[model samples]
Target: MRGGFARPVISLQHAPDLHSLRALLALLALVALSGCSLFREPPAPEPVEAPIAASEAEPAASEPEAASAPEAASEPAETPGAKPAPKKPRPPLIRRHKPAPPPPVAASAPPAPPPAPLVQTHTLERGTFRTLLDSEVRKPDGKVVGRAVDMVAGPGGKPQEVVVNLQGFMGVGDRKANFPWSAVHINTPAKTPAITLALTPAQLQTPERPKSGAPQPGSPEAGPTRLPMLDANVERANGAKVGRVVDVLLGGSADPLAVVLDVSGTLEKRRTIAADWSALHFVTKNNALEAQLEMSDQQIDASPAYANDLPVRAVSPAAPPATPAAPAAPAAPAVPAHGDQ
Candidate 1:
């Protein structure tokens, strides 16, 4: 009996120890459930991405094109049919011009007429000659019949007679007739020295000569009265001064042909002498005669009359020496005999 009691007791101790161990194990399981509530369980990790290669990186950069699409969509639209700008206007062109014409001419005037003749301005001096002769005689028909030959003055210095010679039968048997000075009229205007007669040619042919015893008054024999010679200076037509009258030249015994004048001055310086009757023109106012010839010193020296006998006499302050008479020639010596010893 005692041995059985000891064995039951040993069995009870062993059962209590086993119950304590089972309680400790239940507490450990409750702690594990609370940890699961505090920390969630990690999902299975997504498959890890791989790093891209350089060649494959282009696709990743192209992914930004989706962000640029919204900016392009925000741009404004363009309008249609807008006009082009107008061109600048051009400037206008100017026109050119031409010149004009001249004026017309006027009319001219007419002309005029001519003039007349003049008279000679010379006069004949008085008393230089006793008888005056007409150089020519003309008929009524203007024919020259004869020239005056000689003229004679009466006792009282009057022209008493005029002689004229007529040519008959070709100058043979010439007839000389005496006429009264009253019947002869001087024609100074004729080209030749001429005279006009109131009587016809027949009357001149039968002219009656003046009788010596007839009463001279109221008769054809009555002579021309004498006129005095001018005592004034005489100038030659060439303007030479003639001082005095030396002589007169006459065609016949009683007719006056030309005038001789003496120029006053020195003897070596010869005097002027002129013979042209046409050159004789009397200046009554100056008491001078005018000669028309232009005479030179050589011409005056060569003159026939002046060269031989100088008309001018030199007036010296003192008397000139008397010319001595030439001694008579000695009688020729007796001629010696040809056989003289």
Candidate 2:
């Protein structure tokens, strides 16, 4: 039995040692649990770290995107205003003006014609003698010899006698001679009334003057020097009537200045006058008692004589001769003298 008891003791001792070992193992396990609890590794630590790094990277990246979005929105707002700037308008165009033209021109005109000639005449009127004539005969060497002293009408009231007086000689004898009215020449240019004659200085000097009642041969008192009944009448080339002879105007050159004559039938009638020098014709058979005029009546009226009469004595002595005198005197009177009963 003892042996059996000892073996049981030994076994009991081994069992106590085994119990201490178990106690140590339990303590170590407790310490390990405490350390694990105090310094514990987080659940999924690498995954958590990865998530934090991703969050930081996402903020950085999102910051750039936010700034870019705002810039893009502002760019769109500016585009609308920029579009209106290009559409702004410009100014209008201008034009210029012009002027008008002028008018046309005109033409010119034409010319005119000429005038006619003049003439003179003589006639008888009242008891006092007078003459009618023109101005042309007053020039030097003119045909009319002297102014008519008296103009007497014939029985039918026609011009009958012309008495002409030759002047300038001292009355050595009778310087007066009588001419029939028919012998007077009317000068248009002379502007005077006068008689033209064929008698030269010799014939003019031979006439005898009679005392008032004494009968000189061929005189009115003794029926001497009776004028022949002349069929020819004193007339103008222009056909006007001539009246009566009055006086002559004489100038320095011995040329007849003018012959003064009276118009017939009326007082205050304009007297006819002529230049004695221009007398062209004297109606006489001998041609010795005749002078012709240069101008016609139309020419006389148109001449300066028509405006005013020229002075016969005012003619210069040195003036050239116009017409020459006849070379010889006539032989005898062509008409026969009537008997002095």
Candidate 3:
């Protein structure tokens, strides 16, 4: 009985120690499971609703705000008497405006036309011909006889004869007569000049001038071939009519400087051009005097137009030829030396 009782007691003691170890192991396992819970990942949150576009949403009657006021009100309110959390500053509100459309473009204008060309000019010096119109006629004895009324143009547009209106007392008998141009010497100084006639006033009606009267200005002469100079047709080298002589420009000495040709019909504008007086050659065609110039249509077109107000360069007159000395009176026949005689 005592031996059995001793074995039972040892068993009971071992049993109590084993129960305490099992309790400690169970407590350690509980601590490990709580640590694992701290390390585990959390579940994902639900997605927020997307905002509606301005075009898709219904229009509001009130003034529109840049940020949604309702969204700020939906957040939780701060607690009273508690230290409030620092809030992140909201971004500044910016206004956006739609851009305006561009303006319409304008069409370009056409280019302007080119300018017209200007004309050129020149001058002459010496007096080549005499204009006897309105010049007083004086005799060799310095007696005033008559006044020259008109001139009759000869073959080359030269004055062949001059018509004179003789002065009479109180308009009793004013006779007109024709006299040779060579017979009259021009000594006229200004526009109205007096000339000297080689013949006396009585010789006017002698067979040269008609007993009735000489032809007046613009009248046809009887015997001699009289040609019209002013307003005469101007012909080109090809015998084609280029223009007409509008006027004969004279110098201070009553000499013709140039002939003004009206080339309006051949040019784009109504223009007149000046040609040198020496360059023109007069010819009789169709019983009329015509002037010819050595210029082509292209040459005339390229020339400058003439203007009456244009300034001309004054040319220096040429020196006259020296007069030959008379023969030395035959040297007096060598006046025989007294010693040789």
Candidate 4:
């Protein structure tokens, strides 16, 4: 009986064993279910209702996490029968600036007229040319006609005529003829100095003899007016002979400006002086001609002296020497001023 009771007890223990095995089987199944849920991939997201372009798609949730994710590439869909949008006008590769207007072209001016030619003239003073005195009057063919004796002056000492002495055989038919100075040409600087006459010798001779003590007809001078210029007497107002007229200086008009005088005895110093033509008065005294000065003999001595080697200096207007004021009567000799005689 004790053995039988131990067997039943064993059986009871065995029954609890089946219960534990069942429990273990249920736990293994639960474990298997959990593992499947944990390893299973999630269901795919629902398909989107409308597709979006790559430009309009939302950005990835996390840049760092999704950086390696490949982006979906979608081509734009083209609708049939729809014209493609016109391509935008392309900007020019190189822009150009408006060219500046060309500079204004100046009109060419007319060339200036050629300038007029310049002419130069030189005027010489008198006394610079050789005196035509005693110069042989000749024709153009070198034939001597006569000798020029003197020149007769008109008013203002203008030498209007020249006296020609035609010497005949032994001075027998020697006659004088007065020709206008203009008709005579003097060339003293030539190799053979001569006075050229425009006319031949036949034109100068006359059949009629000139009256005594008279000038030839049509001569610048008549009667006693024909006097030689050189060695003519120059006297002072007091009738005292002062000097002789040695030269007659002519001007541009060939009129005598001044007469150079040889004032030899008129002053202590033997020199010359130029007297203005106006200072001289020509008169015929006793049928003789003389130039009289408006000054006295003493006044002529006070004039300036001149030299032929130097340029001429005209005589200045004579001014009287100032008389010294008489000394104040010697102060009455201080007649004995009281205390001291």
Residue 23 accuracy (lDDT) in model 1: 70
Question: Which scores higher on lDDT, 1 or 2?
Answer: 1
- Kindly indicate the candidate among 3 and 4 with the higher TM-score: 4
Q: Candidate 1: where are CA atoms >4 Å away?
A: 1-134, 206-341
RMSD per prediction, one decimal?
A: 39.7, 32.3, 21.8, 26.5
lDDT by residue (tens digit), candidate 2, 115-177: 222333322212222223222222134544444434333322334454444443564343334
Across 37-66, the per-residue lDDT of candidate 1 in tens digits comes to 656656666444455466654446545333
TM-scores for the candidates: 0.26, 0.26, 0.38, 0.40
Model 4: residues with Cα > 4 Å off, grouped in runs: 1-129, 140-144, 154-160, 167-176, 185-196, 205-226, 250-253, 266-270, 284-290, 296-309, 314-341
Between candidates 1 and 4, the one scoring higher on TM-score is 4
Q: Poorest 10 consecutive residues of model 2 by lDDT?
A: 1-10
Task: Indicate the worst ten consecutive residues by lDDT in candidate 1.
Answer: 1-10
Q: Which residue ranges in model 2 land beyond 4 Å of their true spot?
A: 1-104, 110-233, 237-240, 251-258, 263-268, 285-341
For residues 176-261, what per-residue lDDT tens digits would candidate 3 score against the true structure? 76677677676635443456778854764334334457444324353235754556677865788767866554444444466767
User: In candidate 1, which residue pairs clash?
Assistant: 126-228, 126-229, 234-289, 235-289, 236-290, 236-291, 237-290, 237-291, 237-292, 238-291
lDDT against the true structure, each candidate? 0.44, 0.38, 0.60, 0.61
- Give me the displacement of residue 39 in model 1, in angstroms: 99
- Residue 77, candidate 1: Cα error in Å is 99
